[model samples]
Target: MRKLTDFISESFIWSVGITRPKPGQERLAALYITATLAASILAAMTMFLLVLHRL
Candidate 1:
């Protein structure tokens, strides 16, 4: 499971052209990616709910 997740993350970063982070920056990079994903999902869900409420 862990290896699969690592492979997926590596492929995503590679596809996005995000450079490999230094050893000290791994946590920060991970947090940034996670926060970005979370914020985008939250924004999409909020828009979805607002549209449904209007209808």
Candidate 2:
């Protein structure tokens, strides 16, 4: 679980062209969380539409 979390955080940082956060920078973490939630919501909507179309 720790490895997965670290991998996701690293990937998000790399995608955004940023280095690891320095101390006291919480906004980066919040940005990552929001982005992840948005992506997940989009993925779920896509899957739902696909399934509905097939039915």
Q: In order, how many clashes per candidate?
A: 0, 0
Instruction: List runs of model 1 lying over 4 Å from the truth.
Output: 1-11
Worst 10 residues of 2 by lDDT: 25-34
lDDT of candidate 2 over 2-48, digit per residue (tens): 45555667776678876667776645664665578679999999999
Q: Best lDDT goes to which candidate?
A: 1
| Weakest lDDT window of 10 consecutive positions for candidate 1 | 1-10
Per-residue accuracy of model 1 over 29-55 as CA lDDT, tens digit each: 666666677688999999999999999
Q: Which residue segments of model 2 deviate by more than 4 Å?
A: 1-23
Estimate the lDDT of model 2.
0.72
